[model samples]
Target: MELEGDLFSLTNLRNMEIIDINTGAKLGFIKDLKINCEEHKIISIILPSQTFKISLFGKNEDIEIPWDNVKKIGVDVILVDGKNLVEE
Candidate 1:
């Protein structure tokens, strides 16, 4: 049951928190979206890196979750199927 016909605004999406269904961990909120302009579809949703800014790489990396991995988009949260996606 995809949201094929439902209309959604970016603001509405930004307000919803993202959660990983598999691990039941709060991933983060949407910082941006990866959209396919030609196809007029969303490719993925971007989020701030869970790690600190002082990570080994010296900078935090953004997290990109493929649209296909999204299991459901509820009124308050977007559930994603990320198995072993985050530990701790």
Candidate 2:
């Protein structure tokens, strides 16, 4: 089966950089996603870990950005509220 929407595949989104709409700072690249299995919806986006060693060890302190914070989804970057959404 296939899916369709204004948003493209998750593959396309993985490499896309996440940016803060308020600060205009590049947060990081999306590394994974948190899903609500019951609803079959994306709950949040997980950003790459800060430390390389931790990421290498497969213990990522991934920054999670709630889907509600997403303001815009562009071709190259996803705009979100850094002030509140980004879980540091």
Candidate 3:
């Protein structure tokens, strides 16, 4: 399915898994997605539970994975560049 349609169809996207391309490791579930309403482009992905301490400290670091880093969108997961996650 197309990316936009796949994303919108998901009801509870916050719990959907996201994968790291290089290591094939599950990064985390998506907490939220940043989208540009005017351009209708995805800006970043927010993984709220990746770091427990950060979440506790009231700093939910949303890993801003640019649209270019997205490898694919599956039925229940989003694939992204592992290098980008590591670099952050």
Model 1: per-residue lDDT, tens digit, 1-88? Answer: 2453377789999998999988889998999898999999898888888877555867567788888888888878889987634221
| Model 2: how far residue 5 lies from native, Å | 6.8
State each model's CA lDDT, in order. 0.80, 0.77, 0.67
The candidate scoring highest on lDDT is 1
- All candidates in order of TM-score, best leading: 1, 2, 3
> For candidate 2, which ten residues in a row score worst on lDDT?
1-10
Over 1-88, each residue of candidate 3 has an lDDT whose tens digit, in order, gives 1364433543555656888888988888776677999997777776654565554667756666666778777667778885855212
Better of 2 and 3 by lDDT: 2
How would you encode candidate 2's per-residue C-alpha lDDT over 19-64 as one tens digit per residue? Answer: 8889888888988899999999989998865555454556756688
By descending lDDT, how would the candidates be arranged?
A: 1, 2, 3
N/CA/C clash count, model 1: 0
* Model 2 pairs in collision: none
Lowest-sum lDDT 10-residue window in model 3: 1-10
Query: lDDT of candidate 3 vs native?
Result: 0.67
TM-score of 2: 0.76
